[model samples]
Every structure is written in C-alpha cells, then in structure tokens.
Target: YSSGPPPLLALRLFCGAGDSENLLLGGARARVSRRPKAMASAHPSQGLPSGMDPSMVDEYASQSKLLQEFVKIPSIGKAWVFTSKDENASRAMVSVSQSDLLANKKRSFLLNTHISKSSSKSVSFQWSPFPVEMSGVSAVVPSPSGKKLLLVRNAEDDDSPTKLEIWGPCQLENEIHVARSVHGSLYADGWFEGISWNQEETLIAYVAEEPPQPKPEFNDSGYKKEGSSQKDFRSWKGQGDIEDSWGETYSNKRIPALFVANISSGEVRALKGIPRSLSAGQVIWAPSSSYSLVFVAWSDDNGFQETPRKLGIKYCYNRPCALYAAADPFKEEADKPSTDSNKGDTAALVKLTADLSSAFFPRFSPDGKYLVFISAKSAVDSGAHNATNSMHKIDWPTDGKLEGSLSVSDVVPTVMSPQDGCFPGMYCSGLLRFPWLSDGRTMILSSAWGSKEVILSINVAR
Candidate 1:
C-alpha cells in the first residue's frame, strides 16, 4: 500500500495523432473515496460495459484535480488504480501509445504513491486501475536485469508486417515516471514472427520467416517407400495424401531461422548452420553460463518409417525442438586459446547434443558441472531411465553442420508413482543455487507446493 501528497491530482487528455488509424483520444481519471451504493444491473443491460458507473467511483475530492497531463498522441490503451494505506487513499491511471510501440517509440510513465504507514509489499493489481494500451506489442519480455522491456510490434500499415523494439530502463518502480520513445525511431527489421526469452534475460531469440519458394521433386535423401512399414511423414496420419510441389499452393512455412542478441551491447546476429524447423521447440541460454543453444530433432528414414494403425496427432517426429548450444567466445579467450589439436579446445565449449528419448527444460547445474533435463522415453516400457542412451563426441563441422556429441546421465526414478517421470516430492521449479549450501556439489531447488528449496546434497563430483 502507498500514499501520496496533496488532496488533489488531475491530468489533461488530448486528441489522437492523424497517423493513427483509429484516431480517437481515450482518456480517464481514477480516484478512491466513499459513496452510496446503487442498485446493481448486468453490465450490458446497464449500458455500461462493466456495470461500473464512473460517477459512483467516489470522488473523495469534489473535482478531479489535474495531475498528469498526456497530449496529442495515438491514444493507446488505459487502465486505473486505487490504493489505500494507513487509512489514506489515492488513485493512478496510465495509457500506452500504439503508434509509439508500432513505431518503436519508447514512451511510458510511472507514478509512486508512498502510502502512509506501510512502504514495501507485492505490488498487486488492486494498487492501480489505470488502463495502459500496448496491444500492438504482440509480445513483451523484460530484460534479465529488469532494466529494459523488449517489445515486438506489428507494422501499423496494412501491408507491412511486424518489427522489434526496446524500451530502456525508463520504467522505474514505486511510481517513477516512464520516459516515452521518439516516433518512427523504433525498429529492428524483418517480420518478427515469434519470440522467447532466456531465463537470465540477457539473450533473446526470435523466428523470421523468409518469403516462400517452390518445392522440387525429391526421391533421394529423406524419402523411401517400403511395403510393410511405409508411412506418411508430413502428416502423422497412417495413410494421407501428399500434395504437389507449388510455391503458392504450399505456404511459406519454411523452417524458422533463429537469432540471438546480447542486451548489454545491442548486438544481434543469426545462428547459422543448424537444421531447424519453424515449429521447433524453443532456444534457450545456459542458466549458469553465458551461452546460447537451440535444439531440434530429425530422424532418418529408418527411424520414422513405422507408425501404428491408431493415431491422434500430427507429424510423427517423436522428439521436436531438440536443444542445441552455441556460445560466442569472449575477447580474452579469442586472443589466447590453444591452437593445438591434442590439448583439446576448452575455450569454446563446442555445441554438444544429447541422445535420449526427448528432452525439454534442460538446465545446467549451478556449478556448471551437470545438466538437468526432463528427457522423454517411451510409453510402452514405462521405465525410469532413457531406454536408449547413445553418447558420443564429434568434431564440429566448419560448415555449421552439427555433429552429435550428445551425452546423458543415469535417470533418478521418481520418488512417488515411479511410473510417472515427474515426482510428487517437495522439489521442483524455481530451483536456486544458494550460497549457504555446505557442499558446492549440492544446490537448492524449489517446490511450489508449500516451501522454498532448501540445501540438498548430491553426488556430482563423481
């Protein structure tokens, strides 16, 4: 809860810019006070969207005092907030600019009300009721440092597509006002089709679909027909029709190219030389170390040739979105690593892939010694460990082609309901590496059930 000075605060609203497709300035004022209750009616019936009458929103003060004035901008969206602390009260409202976000404009404002008696607490939804507009920001992600907000916005024009923008450390908590961006100055090109943020918030990856192309006849590398085991690969259907090779007939659904960027330096570049599909699983940064990895899975004709009669899903790729890793070397390492073949290249942790059933949510142990992953095995055996563990190391091909050197540790059976891989034990997500652990080999993992993760020892050094 927070309280602010003055018994009055009001702001001005203005008309929308001509560039805005929807040119109407939407404004609002929010307040906290006491008033008589009115007979309630359903919102649509009351001719009020939420059955909330702005009039009944008690104006503890006779008039809405002018507080924060926002003017002639594309009226984005708006929201309201009311707060109470030490029996004192106040209100807040905010509106975001669509033109601002679409154009990569960095405009935002935050207000702080030092509620009396109390100061710190989880900032809940009830604290403020101001409507803020940012719908054009199809996706938003906060930087690992909490100092910047990344926004992916679609082009305002009908024909143009989406782009990427960054809102710097302008938004400060505790009511610090947000700084706005300059119109038309915001942009990172290419149609930003998808996005996923790493846990550290330092690296970012997105998929950009290229223009469509014609498909050619292929009877060579990937497809073969067998009487007993031949099955459809494109669609998971046991027997499905295959379409002809036409550019427009088939959509421009090419495998999405992935790119990683360093938030600290504004450096962005694409990860090349990896076999990936647009619908692949996510790319992530190693939690304990600073490296980017994208994982994808593909099978040879021998692997996916057979399919059961009964089917309920699509393409039969048992494991998709396999994790792949890449970490650009730092300056010092680039300048001074062994060029010898025998000593081995420890400087650049060559990308390593793990061979198992299927894995997701792969994370490195705090000490960067072991990787913990939830790998998928088969359903028939219903066993505790990966049925097939093929570990190997390969010389990374210079052509950007990945050579498998995937490795895996023995699986630890579930503490409860061993049939299921997931355990009912008080140990799960929000896992943290606490400094207080007696042995560095052990780290703490959190269980959302009831308690935070406590130190637990593990035999990692072995």
Candidate 2:
C-alpha cells in the first residue's frame, strides 16, 4: 500500500439483508468487538530528522491536532446523511466504519460527522487553507469498493446565481454542471431530491428540474404567479415579490428528466424518454451500472400548489410516476481484463411500472436481478412495529430469484427506522452509499431524509 497522507477514506460498508436494533446486524445475531488505534513510536528522542530542530517537532505536533479537527474521515462504503422537510440550511453527517482497512476488521457505526450547512469558511489541511462553502452537500455516495468519494453541492446556475455543483475523484477542484432541472418557477427551482451512484461511483444519477421556457405568442412562457407580472410588479408592495412568480403555462412541459454524466470524459446527457420540458422530481439512480435506471414521479399539475384547484383535486384521478432504464455500453471492470480489450456492449433494457397508491420504496437486490419494494401503504406489526408493510422482489433475469411478495411480520421497526439518529423531522433525502458488506451478495442502503440532514443505514443480507 502506498504510505502517505490519505487521499480519501470512508466509514461504511455496503448493504445486504438481516436485522438489528440497539444491535447492528440482525437484531440479536450481530456481534461487536473493539480494537485499539495504531501507535507510531520510534522513541521520541530518536524521532527528529538530523537537521530538524526540537522546537520544530513541537510546532508540527500542534498543527497535526488542528488538522484532525476538520479532516475527520469515516470508514469506506457505509455512511449516510439525514435532513429536514422544507428546504433549510441545517444538517448532520453520520458514518459507520468497519475498523481496520486490513486486519480484524472491527466493523461498526462508530462516529458521527456533523456540520452546519452554512459553514462557508476557510480551512487548512496540513499547510493549505481549503476554502469551502456550507451551501449544502445535497447528496453523498460511496464508490463500490469505497475507494472514491462522490459529492454533489448546490451551486449558482449559468443563468442564475444558484444551482448544483458536483465534486469528487474525477475532478477534485473543478465543479461540473452535470444536470439541469426546474422547481416551480425561477424562484421555485428544484434542487436534488433523489440520487443514486452506481456501486462503483463511476456513474452519477440525480433528479433536477428546469422551468419551461414559455411560448411567445399564446405561450404565457414567462407567466407570472397570480397578478405579479411585469405590469403588476409595479403595484406589489414587498420583497420576495418575485419568489415563485416566473411560471410557465400549465400545459407547458415541466417534468424533470434523469441526468447521467460520465465523471471522467466530461460527458453530460439527460436520460432518454422524459420530456425535457416537464418537471421531474425525485429521480433515484439504480445500483447496477450496466443499465441506468432512474424513477421520476410527477403530478399532472403544479405539485407544490396547495390549492385544490391547482392540485386539480376534482379532475385529477391519481399520481403518475414511471421508471426509465437506460443501458450504457460500458463493460464491467472484470469484463475488461486487458487494456487492449474493446469497450463493452449496451445493457439490455427493462422498464417497471410500480403501483402508485402505496408509496412503495423500491430497492434493488444486491445482485441487481430483482427489486424489493413495500407493498402496503402502512401497517402495525406489533412489538414496536405498527404493521407489516408489503415487501416485493423481482427476479434477476439469469437466476430468476424474483419473488412476488414477502411477509414482514418478523421485520423490526428499528431496522427500518432511523439507525443513526434520523428522527422524524430529519428524514432521509438521498443515499450516501448503497448496501455493502458481504463480498458482493450483501450491501448497506444509506438514505437521506431531508436537506443536508442526517443519513442513516441498516444492515440487510439477502
């Protein structure tokens, strides 16, 4: 192993199936052990290099302590974040490391990485002050082996002064505009609500919306909210006078599409199928990398509009959400044995239409052959669990392990609830890492509840 300052590190392992409570693995099945931190002693007197001064040694020691304060790192593959409901500027970071990178492997959720979203200040790593902004780490995802870090930040758009900025291994200091999406209007633009990084973190998936550019003639393209148009702005009496005023006509497309970008080649493209104009919120990136699957759920009308008329309560019958899977031609690292080998082929396509009434949480199994989603809207399952919600599995085409439904009477609430302090107010907004642990058959699911909130994970082995 190359010895030097750590380029990056993680604190969590992938997911799988099992169960847990105050216990981590399977409620009672999981066990815990403690190991000690490493020691670097060559005898204090023998330490200093020939030319270094004794005073310099003391100075260096003090600096090291300061760096540890801000450069704290978690284990690889098993970290998550949780946040609030309404968009806010507060959040907490939680992580679980498996102990030694190589050794007894004391795996556990040992530390909490909490930070204020608005902490945009100067920081130093060793001898440099790495300037940082606390705008918010919209999403966090661990690479398959937990070797790389993929983080998305909120940035200023090309047109406006605010948008999403993505940073990580591919380009450490530079930020790229991988996706564009709209919210309600100019002022109501949507941030990232859903994100899923392929197990390897080579691919990035997120949900964003871009307000529709209205038609010039009868388009009402730059339609103003209520009477707050250019003509009415003159009459308005206060600030936020333009918060959500710029809206496209109702009939205009407002759905956000699935955006996938190859972090390396600087390639950015919107997923196929979605109307670039419609508003698509909450896009989830599936774990499998061969095929890109993102789910976009939308409303027939303005989803945020609370008014019954705006909600079309009388006319609207139900919610419309669909799953779109785009297969890329990239081959698995294993498939490419030699550098001279040709690139891989495109992934086979499969589209799933999930039942809407239940608000199912669809999760793909570690093998990527099947999908597991909640079947019931809600239930009371005794012993702390209110009910047994339905759990479903779709067979992986090759193994055909898919099952119609699985009973959940035995599943515990703590396993499904907030593992590392993701209370109600702080719901999971996105996943920092997918299931990890077993060689490949099992992994952890890291989910976020809200803003830069706290994300937690539960261990599951299928």
Candidate 3:
C-alpha cells in the first residue's frame, strides 16, 4: 500500500443508462445485453450489481466495462461512499441500492476501494475484485474508524421487527433488534436519513419513525380506552381518525425522532425533549467533547401568514432548518449522582445555527478545528425542491463551549448557474459525514457541477 498522504481524489463519471443494451466503456463499446429491453433499471439499487458477471467477465474482459454500467443508474437512492478516519486501511466502501419494487424488497452491493483517479473524459472505477451482495438491506453506513459497517434491515412485514447488524471485515460482530413499539420503518431516503456513528464507535445515532399512536378500539357497546378489555368477534372496530404526517411523502407515518443505539449491549435510548411539533434528521456526532449529537430540525414555524403550514420536506431543502446539538442520554445518566432519586432533565439542547435558513450536512474537520456544511438557502428562498447550493464553515470553539453566537462563514458562495466550461455550482443532496482528507483542511464533496454529478475538492483553509 502507498504510505504517503492520500491525494486529492475524485469520482469517475459515466454516461446515463439508456434504452439500448450496449454500453460505451473506456473508448470501447460493448454489447452485453441479450434483449432490446433497457440495459439496467433506472434506479441504482435495481441496476445490476457492480462488476460483470464472473461467467461473462472472461468473454467481455476486452471491454473492461468496470463502472460504465455501475455508474449509470439514475437514482442511487441513499448511496454512501466513505473512507476510514484512521490510516490503517487505505480503502473505502461504496454502497449502492438495488431496490426492486416487484419483490417489495431492497438490496445493496458493497464495493471496497480507494477512489484516487479522476478523468476528464471517461468514467472509471477501481472496483473491489468483486462486490459483496447484501440482501434486504434498508440502509448502510460506515463507522468513522472504518473498522465496522452498520447494515439495517427494516421490517417489511408489519409484524416483523427491524434488525441492525454490525459487521467487521470478516464476519458479523453484533446484532440488535428494535421492536415496532420503539420505532417504525427507518428514514432511508436521502432527505431524512440521519444514521451516524460517534467518534468512539460504540454508539450509533439514527432517524426513524416514532412509535405509532394507538388507534381507538371499539366494541359492540361503544369505543373504549386503553383500560378496556380486548374486542371479540361480536364487536367490530370503526376506523380511527387519520393522523397526517406533514403531507406529501410522509402519509400515514409518524414524526421522525432521534435515537441512539449501544452496539455492544443492544440497547436503544431515545433523546427526550424533542418537541413533537418539530421533525429531526441528518444527524451527526459532534466532537465527543462538545456535544453528543448534532442534527437538523425542521419546525412548523410560520411568520405573518394567516395559517401556519408545514412545508413538504421530502427532497425539498426550501423548508427552513437549523442545526441543533444535544447531549447523549446515556452520558447524562452517568453524570447524575447515583443516590439522587430524581434525575435531572436531559442536557440543554442548543441551537447552533440561528442565522442560516437551511443548513444540513454537518462535517467536522479531521483535526476538529472547523465544522463545514452546505446550505441550500437559495433553494429555500426560491421555493424550489432542488437548486444550486452554498458551502460554509464555522470556527469550532477550542474549549467545546458552544452557543448560538457561533457565526457561519462562506466557503463557497451560492452559484445559481455555472458559466460555460467552469464547474457548475454545488448540487449536493447530502454529504458523507467524514468527507475529509488526511490533511484536515481539504474536503471531498460530490455536487451536480454540470450535466453529471462531479466530485469536488474544496480547501476550506483558504
């Protein structure tokens, strides 16, 4: 393995998947399809797994169609590309969804490698010798240490429970099962996915649907409360009043809540005091010394309007959100005096971004000197679901003394539209939590720089 500092790396771009079965790869065109049907499913998860089928690899090896097909899927749906914080391994994991609606199930392929190549003309991927197929995976995230991977299998059957599996390089290390009473389906979509691992690697924070509210049980006599006995066949139940979850994408779902899981003991603790009026997502661990959690909270706050309305947040950044930090629940319990029967309330939750109208992805520098994030204020102000973005940074307090006084500074100003040939403005849906290089100053972010989503290297130190 190369012992030098990792170079400024970039991603390989591919032509969009099309109706034809032939794929143009590295200047060589390969007709790998047998039918007139579309080469691959539009969604990445539904697309063929990375790497040509081993049987076909021998015959089509001449074409070297490594990532030509792998990179072409239209919607990567919660894709994750991450590298380890420690230098022990110089590789990274790229997880792509292959969700199949017909099967009503989701799966993913894990390709491990270091993306150190950038080409101006062609797409390339030094894919791991082969991809590991993870079946029925709802979400996947890599730990900061890169030594562990978290794979989530959401309950597909209403009665089934959610399963969280922690895997090391060789085999499964631990597993945790969360009951439906504790939470419902996880928020795996890009906008609501908040899964994160703390610096210590022992705890994981994520966003999931809160436990559903109980429906009213009706008997032959009348409607009954919780204390009432079970209904018999003679008693038919009436439909309960429907609860709307902020409209649009969240139909029949409850509000999203923040939860922390202890990997070793398989315990989950919900952070208390998050108002039901607000929804939380895109959570990341703060510098362990400063705070336990940092997440974006969207509130139902309206100013001067006749009726208060909840903005549709799915794929929409225009909904106003600000970063907030809170202490880990377990830590708070430990700090309390053991003898004190009355435990104090959860640590005070602090709002870190009072000035930013839309700030989400939170990435702390490798050295922990700065907290960098991307803003979609332009989209928020323009009322568009998607638009150009801005990058900003905050000088983190050395003593971990955080307050609302933290000021946001621009690193990359908003670019509405890009001029010819130059890089198009930022269009990142979200960023990898530890998207930093070894230098601690430069970060690698993927944005819709142009017709294609391009990887960019930004030097915040400048």
TM-score for all predictions? 0.40, 0.41, 0.71
Model number with the top lDDT: 3
The runs of at least 3 residues in candidate 1 whose Cα sits more than 4 Å from the true structure, single-residue gaps closed, are 1-126, 154-159, 171-203, 208-211, 214-253, 262-268, 276-279, 287-291, 294-321, 328-353, 365-367, 380-407, 410-462
lDDT of 1 by residue, 372-434 (tens): 544333421243222322111222233443345544554343343433443333333222212
Candidate 1 C-alpha error for residue 71, in Å: 32
* Whole-model lDDT values for every prediction: 0.38, 0.39, 0.73
In candidate 3, stretches whose alpha carbon ends up further than 4 angstroms from where it belongs are 1-89, 96-107, 112-130, 220-223, 228-241, 246-248, 302-307, 338-347, 415-425, 449-453
Select the stronger candidate by TM-score from 2 and 3. Answer: 3
- Cα lDDT tens digits, model 3, 192-241, are 78898888899999999998667777676786677667647766655566
Residues 1-462, model 2: lDDT tens digits? 223222211111222322421224435444333222233343343566753444466667777766555344545533344334533322333434433433544433423333333346543222113223222354445444434555555445445422334454355633555333333212122322455566555666665445334422212344345533355332423232112211333333234445555666655544544443233444554543444464544333333322222232112222233343444323333455687344333233344444422223456656665554433223212211122233334443453322343222211132345446434321222232334344543434333343343434443334
RMSD per candidate (Å) reads 19.3, 23.2, 14.4
lDDT order of candidates, best first?
A: 3, 2, 1
Highest TM-score model number: 3
In candidate 2, residue 371 scores what lDDT? Answer: 50
